[model samples]
Target chain A: MRLPSCGCCAIAVRCRFWESRIDMPLIEVDNLSKTFRVPEREGGFLAAIRSVFNRRFRQVHAVRGVSFCVEPGEIVGFLGPNGAGKTTTLKMLSGLLHPTSGTATVLGDVPWRRHSEYLRRISMLMGQRSQLQWDLPALDSFMVHAAVYNIPKDQYRQRLDKLVEMLELGPVLKKQIRTLSLGERMKCEICVSLLHGPEVLFLDEPTIGVDITMQARIRDFIGDYNRRYGATIILTSHYMADVTALCKRVIVIDQGRILFDGQLEALSEKLAPFKVIAIDLDADTDGYDFAALGDVLAKEDRKVKLRVPKGAAASVTGRLLRELPVLDLTIEDPPIEDVIGRAFGGSSGVGPEEETSAAESQGGDR
Target chain B: MTAVARSFFAFLRKGIAVMLQYRGEIVLWAIWGLVNPAVSYALWSAAAESNADGTIAGFGRGEFAAYFFAMMIVGHLTQAWDTYEIGHLVRSGEMSPKLLRPILPIWEALAGNLSYKITTLAFVVPMWCLFAWLVRPTFDTSAWQLGLGLIAIVLGAVLNFVLNYVFALVAFWTPKLDAMGELYFGACMLWGGRFAPLDALPDILRWLSGLQPFKWMFAFPSELIMGRITDPSEAFRGLGIQLAWIAVSIVGFRALWSVAVKRYTAVSG
Candidate 1:
């Protein structure tokens, strides 16, 4: 039996595509699925050769019935825990992979068809791979792109000069690609990718391996580029700062499905956002049995901590102070990463401060 | 017409600039260029020296040297390794930016191959001349033969480009295409007269090899240069076959490219 086709389906409401709750999303996907057959192997050299002839195949579904949408010029972050099919979805959108079943349309274009006009409108940068030739200087690579993109010589020069200045690629342009550092190479790659001034920028961890300063620089440049060109940006990174700094809306996927897709602040509130409110009481206070209020996180000689829903934080904190002994109280936001970690069946001790640096580095891994 | 040529040459200039930066690797590649063909020539020359009748098939020692040396030069000039390259580009999603451009990807690949060939030809020319002088074959160098040789070489280059590109598109389907690449080179080495002339093979093998485009790439050209295929009828058939293969390859490439692109989605799920 054939699987049902559900095109770019998502539960998120008031999306950029939905102006009056009746408008369709600029990008839509429905019941999208992709499965791959990987060979099952046995040890031994002879067996390896035998397997090559009589291969054993196992089907692994990378994306299963997942969907979402973005409006023109809206910067959206495609987020997910590791191996949650973020890259798989991005590849499908970029026309790099065929969906096994379902539908995906970007600005009304079926990406896999590789329509010439559609191709000319978008560009993708997968962090681990570079488009520039390894034997060439960045200038030479840029020149090749200028011709391929059919950029006028005059316009090419102006855009190149601006990119060089913004990316600080002057020191690296003349150097062979092999001689350039990782950060330097990434800068050149970005410059090369942008030569055509593409309208839709699909950046998959374009900042991976770059230094913190370089990461921030790239993010700023991305913002500036998007503002100047009004290009739609779809970025995927493990770094929360990337989403917080650049994207107002985020779609978080887990196990090849959309676990949460909405505004970043709204998602935070929807998930467990209230930090464990810990109160240290006077030494004279009797043993506080506060298990009924919420999940008790910890207890010390004079301190008691409680984990509660974001909506109940104010009332619970007020009640605790009014009804029981309380000396000091502190409230904070729970780390999104930690909350996501638990939500995805991953138990961890990720503090809130670590999210920024972790997310910043994630900028490099698409 | 003016717009296309202008754009092509602009990209070609960029291709040359890119190749210039690999000067260090160029030296290493030159060393490989000398060593690989030299070994093949030496081994076959040794084999020919052991011929019981002093002539194995139609090739004597002198003729073998002349033919192999010419084949080596032609092979170096016409070779393309971009198939493996395209695979990497697809897997890593680097093909994205290239596709984003106005020009087709094949044109860029062709320009890249040309840039590499012209740079590396410096080494091929010297090596060819050095080997030719060592294995001297007393021969006439008439203007007709020289002109025909020039034409044949140009035809050989075109044939090689078509063959390589047509197979390179296979990378779109076959991820690990090293075996296919080796098979292609092996065919050229054995039947194309890159190792020894097809005439030197058994009569049956010679007949079959003559039917191959590989023969047009090397054996046919070497024979024309030597003024062997002087009969107008035979020369016409040889040249015509080369053109036919070019036509076939062009059509084949157009069809294969569309099919191959259908399979490429840009990334592994």
Candidate 2:
């Protein structure tokens, strides 16, 4: 069987196609980078005192030459390990930080220039931070934003009602932000941010500490908002479920470099090509050789789990059913967490590609 | 209202709402502001009594009472606390969200300052009036001089605010601005004529105070209201100096702000 084209290569082709049709992308980033100069201090008191007069400094390259463009109405996942320059890139694009070199344009305006016209059309939310006044009800803070954005009284009221109803935020609107649950506060945060109806949204780990149910709800809201407004969105998250659920296309980075950028399914095919099959036998397995079917990855009680190449998974399952007393069985792709772990060169367990095909040869199954 | 004015009023309203939560703090600050003037009045009154003659440093007992009372009002009207605020915002990285807004973050500070002054004055002005009645202080300025002095006081407040804000921008590079704030206040006390009338200081110190912008912030306004500089030409000169300082401060604030913002965003990035 032939493997599909790599997602990263396909992105280049898609970008070229987009360029042919449009003069400039909605968000265009070209070799944008950021570097920092961190001071170094010696441990000893004498050395520290001496260093004060003549400081030692080291250059830290937080973001290297990273280039990518986001088209209008695209919900793209920005996936990367910690310290991989995800937040730095977001800051540069949002005008919070200027890039050390290179340039980026958001909605045809340079982000670092922080043009009021450009700012009024974009919004950003960070998960761990709260922009709402803590001691005041979320409504009051909403009013502040309404004023900041200069929303006409009637328009502001209309938008507030719509957002409140859509988010089911009536119960929590009157409560002070500090008293609200994390999820409730996050909802309010999202609501207040959208009162301006910005064209572009940058969300950085917006569900970091939210519970599973809340995370799902937030993801749904994000999807609904994108569809309703045709708003372009760029989200960075550690949860694979979020990326897989909301993002059809994802950009993966490691060490400030773009490792992969294209369709989400294509990424799985490129990085991890095998699937897992778990079998639960009705009878004891002492008399049969399970390893002949595939490489056994794990075994416990009467259940056996096996790893096999994607192409061979069906044939191997058919043979197992014919030759073994199989009570139940299921085939699934490798978990994305493990795949990304391996992509970052994590050596804690089996490497994604090196995990050879296997049937669960009996160990504890008997 | 124009767009900018609308935004300013909106922020002003929000600031008032937030400040209402800290009413206790306002009361405490008002008390502290009054105490400084009380101390100055007491010291000057004692000096006037001891002088056998009816005057000390050109201040009669009634004149000293009037000077201290005016000084108290001017000081409260011109107070700035932006150094502590900007330092906290820079230190804790809370300035991030503020910067993302279309408006400059400084506008929020300005609005907040205005709200605080307006709210506190409601309570403070009545108390000051009662105190002035008890002290029986005299006001000798003509109607025109009094009107010009009010303008001077407003300019003085703006000058002090811009001066402190410019200094506070140093927090972009270093979070430890408390020392700098204290240093600035100390200079004001020594040279801005908080402790005594500029006439009471050594000739050299008084000359230096006149040359620097410090005296114009507090002493010039208070003295103008008290009619201490009776010469019309001298009073006009004082107003001119205050205007010059205000111009200098605005330019300095913009320059420092540009550099500080660049340093902050670059380093934090």
Candidate 3:
């Protein structure tokens, strides 16, 4: 069999072909699982000493039977709380960790096999890890990355210039990475990872630890990269805004199991089957009961907020308008944060039965 | 250039640049490399001087000086610390980034080893000359011996690096490997003839040293350069042993690396 050429033209041609196949999935993962054998011992001098002689280990199933397909040029968000196997799944897909069982293929190659061609075509950006040389200037690290990926000189220069301009990294290019701010360092990390124009990007918390503005800026850059290069991206982040902004589809995982997978708006509609209605009453009716209409979320002097079932939102609004002297009213879906919080069974104060009843009620009303 | 060569040179350039940033630290490390051979020379020379015939195991004070001086240079050239470093890289999760690259991480590490040696040469060369002048060691080296010895040193460096890297693969299984590094260093000291010449050792130790590859790494090159091995066939045999070890080490590295990466937990992200 002939080996593929590692060149810009080859990558461009392959990317265009993959991009043209809109229906074909660029990445396919099937029943993928990773179990880590971690040594455990109680915290104490005696336990530590005893454990040295009689070591005990427990299996931690970081990722359990995770299976997802990502099409070309799509950005899919991997949502979860800490230790939810978000990073673990990304690691396995990026060829950094071997899955204990199951299989994954990215761009027609098994990822864990780690063929040089497969590695050259993909990039993984770990927000907490620094791939650059700490004491050297960011530009130096970029040059090294270019060489490591075997990028042609002209193409390397052109891409470097484009990335520098897009990332606004001209000023910080010559500065040592250690001296740069956390946001600046992250930008440099992104810059180096993209120097090869990888077709697949596994970004684990790409916007983590940055300020709000920086996070948004990084998100924009990532979106722009995906649009321009037709790259397939899998991103994991704790910030709901990141998911809401970049990803139309999200996979919510918890405790090594995928809880939900669908459109972002659909997640809210399915998981949090309620609409928040805020009303500016014209007059304060002290004798009126708001709970009869829906769940009273807030009752201030003039303004009142009600959490009405999605199916009954219109009826509740009509009743409130007829009974109360309302000045203005607006209905909106619950925040993504709240929806995800409820998905994880967090402190959202809503029980599983309420969620089930809400779904049933919405279905029946529809 | 080919992709591998270009990547190697790039890593070498970055390694050299990083080393240049710590001039004082590099000089200190270079001096530390010298101190071991110097102390060994002193102890052995004193022992030779106290002998009835001013000789022990056919080596007088001057012969001991020559042996140690050559050993110092040989040791410096053959130095590798992956055994000490791999554990830290594994524990701190620094190896993950390197593993992501298309090339093997060992290329970058080899670049780092060469860069350190290159950067420290300026400080160490002058110190070596000073040591030679102070010790006034004698030399019986021929042109052919010197040429073959230089070739041996290069082979010895390759052998040492590959073997040490293969051993360092243990870090993937057990991340805390400082004791392993110490054991490796101790073995090299005893068997590689760094602490004392192999012939001067007791019969059991001398016999044991010949059984391992460390003798080919440090002892053979040092003895060859000092013109102690007069037989051409013996010198060739030593080179053959070094080549065999190099091949074994490369195979061992490939075998261990395939398994080690699978075992990597990638601890901290």
Top-TM-score structure, candidate number: 3
Residues A181-229, candidate 2: write the lDDT tens digits.
Answer: 9999999989988999999999988888889999999999899999999
Clashes of each: 17, 7, 0
lDDT for each residue of candidate 3 in B140-163, tens digit (9 for 90 to 100): 999888888999999999999999
Residue A137 shift from truth in candidate 3, angstroms: 0.3
- The best candidate by lDDT is 3
lDDT of 1 by residue, A1-366 (tens): 122133233332344544534444556676678887777888999989999889999987788776556777889887776777888888888776778998887867898777767766788888877777787677877876776567888999999999999998888998989899888898898898888888888898888888888888888888889888898999988776677788888877655666666678766665556666888886655655688788887776777878887778899899988987678898765555556766544423544234323333322121
Determine the iRMS, in angstroms, of model 3: 1.3
Name the better of 1 and 3 by TM-score. Answer: 3
Give candidate 2's iRMS in Å, 1 decimal: 1.6
Model 2 CAPRI rating: acceptable
Residue range with the least summed lDDT across 10 consecutive positions in model 1 chain A? A1-10
Comparison by TM-score, 2 against 3, better one = 3
Candidate 2 per-residue C-alpha lDDT over B148-244 given as tens digits, one digit per residue, 9 for 90 to 100 = 7898889888888888898899998888688888888887887888878888888999998878888888998898888777787888888888889
Best by DockQ: 3
Tens digits of per-residue lDDT, candidate 3, A1-366, equal 222221111222233465553233577776788999888999999999999899999999888776666778989998877887899999999899999998777898988889999999999999988899999999899999989999999999999999999999999999999999999999999999999999999998988899999999999999999888889899999887788889998887765666666678876666778889999988779978889888888998999999888899999999988988999999987665566666556634545455434433432221
Off by over 4 Å in 3: A1-23, A272-338, A344-366
Pairs that clash in candidate 3: none
Q: Which parts of model 2 have CA positions greater than 4 angstroms off? A: A1-21, A42-47, A271-338, A346-366, B52-54, B266-269
